[model samples]
Target: MTTSESRDEAVGSGDVDFDHHSLTFRDHPHEALAELRSRGPVLHSSAHDGFWVLTDYASVFEAAKDDARFSSAESVGIPASGMPFPILPIESDPPQTQQLRAITMTPFSPGTVKSLQPDMREIATELIDAFIERGECDLVQELTTPLPARLMLRMLGFDESTWRSWVERVHLVIHDRAHDLDAAMTAAGSLLTELGTEMERRREAAPTSDLYARIVHGSVDGVPLDDVQITMYGFLMMLGGMDTTSGLTSNSLLQLCVQPNLRQRLIDDRSLLPAATEEFLRHDTPTLGLARTVTEDATMAGQSLKAGERALLMWAGANRDPAVFENPDEIDFDRENKRHLAFGVGKHRCLGSNLAREMFKVMIDEILTRLPDFRLAGEPVRFSDAGEVHALRHLPVIFTPGPRRK
Candidate 1:
């Protein structure tokens, strides 16, 4: 177990020194997770006032589905997001999760998400047009970041120009939380306030098809959603929508840089992208893992967990479990069993998964078509946090200057 600080020193002799947010974990997460999995499927970590780490596929998958026993109502982050309100959907259990999810799931349905292809392509083209002639651009800033942010803004019924602030606020809250907890909470609070204001505006405006309108006008069990519910739901949308795809796409692009053969395969045959997308989602999972609170005393993988104890379901590690995925470390687009928990499992699965896949495919298609020879211009600067969304802060790439589609 190689780390900046020795294990005993970090853990104080009694508990396992498994700080998910540690520098070692951040730098080489797969290695860190593999080491943890090697130890056992369920190990108590001394980090963040102690929590159980579920590493294997069975434990994580089972726990994810058993929300009755492993509740999400408490906190999804190990250190607990000190937000005054729940993030909605993901932070709630069963009945409430289902109700809240139903409100926003309509727009993300396969048909609806598929209909947005043209719009996504248009957005992708316009973004690429801004940088195609430059020969080099930070992919994160120039493409990966704004594409989703702009689309999320449109969905939220907000002005596209405000994407930058929304993106920054989301990044600060999710990606930078491990570094500065206070700043992250502050950003979360501020974003909630901003979202609340937007919801109020939506209330006065005519009925629209945007997400904000859906939440503002939405009802659960025939009762209209309250202001807090509206804001929290909208806040979840802002966080999940803007961050995950950005990280997944940016991370996949980095993978292409190191694996030239994979890049060429994609360039040669565009049909393989859909499969590749699944593999990438599995291999470079964006939301590393989420925490679950034990509803009652239960034994999982033969480990006793008392009531109220916290357990971190390591989704990334589970995806790579050799017991489920053969040659798990290697990238394989032809993987027949693409049933990975990258978006999670059971009732709490990512509601926007359909849109996320479509977004990834569209962005990849546009980039691979326009910039076939793209290569890493510089090292990618990854976010320091591994507690939630495992994302790259910046990914610099260069390619032969080309003409804009627009």
Candidate 2:
């Protein structure tokens, strides 16, 4: 058989070995991906225990777009034991996915998020105030984590009382092993069930202008969304909004802190914040990659992939692909044409991307204006193990507390 045919058969059968590579690919994934991209864009690998990884920009993007050709129904990587429900729209497709997106999109629109900006700014400033007083703080805990959680809670009309528990549950759910997975999943499910019931009650008794009420009572094609769908969507929104943005924020700050010159530049000229955000995202995409199962035999970069095989669309690798990005390793804040897959590509692109960009803009603008010369107090811990989300576990920084003007 031809090389392409062999690779195709491997991918089609979900027969790639995943154990050869290191757990996180922390040292040099870009270089490895580049080698794969050059040799064969869609090569099969039985690494990381066993899973097919699709490396390269064009092929990964193509796989992501053609959902029909690459199904998401199968257990992608390792399933969380005892979690009966599939992880929202991420694990779903077509009509159901579209319906869920429509309902969830209402609260995350530009207008809705823009309206919440003032409140977000206030919260950001409050956190900054505390950090400034201390002169040193952990950015992840003090700033990044809380900001997004608060925004998500407010958007969903959920009580702040449960925020800590919910956030903890999510972190554990994502990071913990199979033994702890059941408890984590149970906590998340129970929390959502309560929230869903409360949402339904509010919808019936006094429909509010909040997102929860809207989704609980909303309809698509004259069909009202069921409780499970609403709850799942809410869970997704909460998870998506909190973790990814928090990761982005912490990663951005970590990058800025490490690169003193960039920090000074942003301090001197706040106009570079937008470009800086893009650079940070491209350099360290929050979500690493998404998984897909091949549905039929197909050719990718001259390699034929067969039916019912699993493959990972490496967004992180694609973002760093030299063919698409100039000087992919260098962090160019002033990049003229930034087209990174930090938020993904194609139809399943992150729906909250616009909101995420705006959030970063606002948060970064506030930080530049306040703590301009922030420096790292210690080494930042990168969360490289969360299969798809890349983030920093802790980012300790020291800075002169800027005066609270606002």
Candidate 3:
């Protein structure tokens, strides 16, 4: 309850001292996950007020599919405290979650993301340009934080001027352990206010084509969405579409920074970009896990569970499950089994996967192309909380100062 994970106490049938929310868990996620995977697929953690961990790939996947058994209504994250509201699409079940997803796709669809590529590239260039001549910069601050934030703001049809403020609040709420619940709610409230006002404004009149407009007027299969319902989409926009992708990009770059050989391969041949991104996602999953409330009594992998039990599908651990993946410990772009649940699986899979994947490609493409020789300037400052999302707080890198791209 206090720490994300402290010492072990016994819980359900599968007793394991695993806590994804813990500083200890974040510090050595692989070792901890390995222990859980070895011991039990359905592990009961006496941490964060006792929850089960679905460490094995099969168990997690099966449970992900059985929506009735494993519902998303409780909490998507292991609440350090409590959130005022549940994030839309994520916390909602099918029909509603699926319906909101239908509207959400309009903004992030393949063509939409493709059309924005020039802008994305330009923004990437601009950010790198600022630090390219300095020989060194905090990649997390200089690049990672802003790229996805700017893009997300554009997607949600927000004014560009407020990007930094939103980004700051997002980082504080998500990556900062000290302000997890309060800051998350405060930031969520702030966005809800702005998004609500804008949504109402759009509903009144004088509308243009933007993601916000579509959602405000969105009716899935003819059922209309209301204002409060629409604003919940805003909540999802702020939480799902922003810092999570930032974490993905930052973690990918950090991988390249440390592994010079892996860095060089992608730089030499851009064809490797897509697969490479997958490997990076697999290696350092941005989303550590997702939470589900067990709604009915069930047996998973032969283990029985009661209704109302909380289970965390440890995606990071599942991605690294030795049974499914060969040499799971090694980071291999060419690794044959690239099926990672980094972006979750089943009905509740990440709605922003297209955007996330493309952003990772561009971010990595730009970094390797521009700062080919950049290496870690210092040790990375990782997030204190690694339960919901495993993220990098700061990553300093140094390279030969290069001329700015025209």
Candidate 4:
């Protein structure tokens, strides 16, 4: 067979046409990714709106690290122009990006995250307690969705009463492309303005120990942050802490429920939570891939990319590339060199990765301890669009409640 034919056979599955698939790439893009990896570490696909999708782990890592050559200034999603606003740090490159990331990362350091562990566990338990008696509950709604939102609100000093509205606004911003971008942008802008005002009010009244205060008064390079910067940081933090954690928690729970043997093993040995979390991230990262523009003409994996052309660093595809990960399809909790690009790589690696890991660790530990026998209610599954992030619109499950503690 010709090289192209072999590559096509490896990546192609009759379930979905790579040429026509949009929004929802395929029922199983991972299978296609594996096939592509076999044919060549990197191959341009008709997918991703005809832009090059990098499927090899090493090349994806290289692209993520070589930010000078590949710029992140473009829109993250398709259609390019309609995104409401540039996701600060994420959409920025170089000096400005570095400064913003430094400011944001300060409040999310390992110590700060560790300090919040007790609070996170308390929140998880409180949510779990509410539903434990029912013996059957949708873990996504009951636990996964609220835990991160509540944590972020508390961190930012926002009222819990407004969590639902904020969640809806973020969802609309991220998922509802049908809605007018102007309207969504206006709504998000107004919401952040309100948040900023509230933050300023809190600062004037009495300095409070919270992320909002830190940002409102914090400085980068001897210059304090302005209202706009503070607002952008607040909105970005809220969205980042909310959606990604929710998606990860829901996805991990689904995996546990479906794999009874794995679930039992985890329950028997709680120490496995951290490794299991890493494996889950490697297996199915929430954010699929990140985009970057070629700053200068460059060759990648033997293909020439022109200046100003866009390329996708497929994190999900990379994590599953057999070239770096042996038996990439399987979820091996004990896999050595568990350095997965689920958190991206280089300067743009997620600042909240530590917090995310902690959140997942706490929630998974609590769930396995309290609901060891948790099982799916009926084919507990995920949404159709597994593109940007592998999220579950709904994850229904049934579990035998654990023994009541004194």
Candidate 5:
């Protein structure tokens, strides 16, 4: 049989069609991955134009570190989107990636995130007040969506009024691909154009600590980033920070909605929230795994891969590998090794993880304290194509009224 037919049969000869970019994994990622892992360590998927899926932790982490062999110099899109411009350090290889990463690191430093905590809490509280007395609200629409957008505004020195526009447009660009590709690209183009204008504006103004100023004035190898590079960096910040965290918040909250028992567990012991956070990240990671290109022909987990090929380092799959975690499907916050590949592994690890963690902690804490009894008001909506971003489009919840905090 040809490789295409074999890949089609890779998941038990027609029993289940497993494609990394298909609605199958997006809707049933755990179930589908459990089946794939049972087959072997790696399987070729015809999804998103055919790519390799890394099914185990060992394989994913190893390939992540071994960039020379599984290089990230080209488009990292699982199906390889052939992006016109690089997403800065993420698309750059080795030495150059290092330099670009350095220029982008200072703004997301731990200290910076710590200083932003008060702002984070304030944002969460303000969001709760908007619909707290209504006895029901779509958590994704009311809180999760706006939280990241507003935070990004504050972090990057954008006008607070534009937060809603930014949030709506960014969500469309990243998560609406399945329903509307033209709209997604249009949203992306608008964001990039706005970013270019913002970058130029910041450059002409006084330097500040916000990411915009840093990127506009920040130098790489003692040279300022050119228009394309600066704009790309800004684009990455908006893309990387906004929708991913929004989805993470929505996904984690959905678990709380469905698993009432888990909610009580968190309520009983708030300290476990940190552990719970890690567990949620492990089980229902929001963003899809980034793409890595194959530098040369190689064999991984008994699968023969050719040079110039792309491999999706699927973190969502690896974190659930039973070989690595005992009772892989179950959520155990007490697991000794809480280190999941949620933020990814290796040099390309998430730069803004600290910011993300703080947002999750603050958002969840606010929800539990204010609306402990919130339950699903309606069915949650998810994306049609789980290829790029695994997120909820809508999540409605019902709860009793609570006094708004000043």
Candidate 6:
């Protein structure tokens, strides 16, 4: 159908020409999101070629779980990335999605992630030591960004020295996509080249424990994955492993910088860090949300949607619904039902959740113990647009100069 027809069918209550990537939305999403949610559970936005916005807990939850009617096969980004290859598992529906997910499941599995904690802690320590005696640092560049990238490289058997390049490429694609589509596409192409080259190398070598080797030799129903499929797997892994965790960690640290009491509380009782992590995730929601296509003519949140229409499941909105969580705007570590949709929900839930959580706790623990007096040296710089991933580009912080722990 034409874009006009799509808009016509989407006309209903709660209608607004909402653009999640808009400057207004990025600068003040909480206020904008609250206004959107107050309109109704679902609203039609004549943005990104026209799509419905699922703004409440029930509607977002229902749509996310019932993927049959609300499909992910078409695209997950509001304005699609326009990549040459499909983003596995996330951008695909069932069967193929499940198969692709299974191939990478082992590396991101809870058990596997748990085993990497010591290394995670060591990386955090080494990163802190790099600038501990300097009295100040940019947390995003010095710590958050590299920690995940280095870990991912270690898992893929790639040299960790190239972590900065990997981080830049992934960040360019994710944080720059909204404003600079061409740059994002170019970064994606570069990523594909690097990943493709590595996959080729793995193909000629004997299978091993690294994630690259696994994907290179992996199969679906006994059929070996093609080079394109392997590259896509690598692409997805790089994005998943690097971006969201850094965003979540950096956002949480920003909170501590602004809320001294919160920092002191966590320092006093480190156990509270885990609960605080959940609350931070619920409030900050690094991933914001993902997009889905209406598979068949369906009614959701009392709104009519036609097949091929797009709907954005706003996790950030759903996580703050008053009906579900008390004082939804406030961060409550004591929240009993911390079942927030930060990592998302249902079949497409984040596979790296365990690792992300562990990484967050470890980073927070190290920071609190060593740089307990750290405070913001300047305003944190958020990404230009946060439609796909909510992130900070810089977090300048200062503390009493200390000796390098390592």
Name the candidate that leads on TM-score: 6
Model 4 agreement with the true structure over 170-229: per-residue lDDT tens digits: 665554433356765666776677877876787677888777777777777899877776
Estimate, for each residue in 91-148, the C-alpha lDDT of model 1 and write its tens digit. 9998988998899888999999988888899899999999999999998898888999
Q: Residue 181 CA error for candidate 3 (Å)?
A: 2.8
The ten-residue window of minimal lDDT in model 2 covers 13-22
lDDT of candidates 1 onward, in order: 0.87, 0.72, 0.79, 0.74, 0.79, 0.87
Residue-pair clashes per candidate: 0, 13, 0, 1, 0, 0
Mind giving the per-residue lDDT tens digits that candidate 2 earns over 127-207? 888768677888888878888888777877878556677777667655453335566677777767776777768766866
**lDDT, candidate 5, at 11:** 38
Point out the higher-scoring one by lDDT: 3 or 6. Answer: 6
Q: Show the lowest summed lDDT stretch of 10 residues, model 4.
A: 1-10
* Per-residue lDDT of candidate 3, residues 44-127 (tens digit): 767777777888898888878878778886667665325556667788787567777887676778888788888789889999
Clashing pairs in 1: none
TM-score against truth, every candidate: 0.95, 0.89, 0.93, 0.88, 0.93, 0.96
- lDDT per residue, candidate 5, 64-178, as tens digits? 8887888887877764543478877678788777778888687678898888889988989998999999999989878887888788888889997688788777777666654
> Candidate 3, after superposition: displacement of residue 269 in Å?
1.5
Judging by lDDT, tell me the better candidate of 1 and 4: 1
Candidate 1 displacement at residue 267 in angstroms? 1.1
Models, CA RMSD each:
4.6, 3.3, 4.3, 4.8, 3.4, 2.5
Which residue segments of model 3 deviate by more than 4 Å?
1-13, 176-180
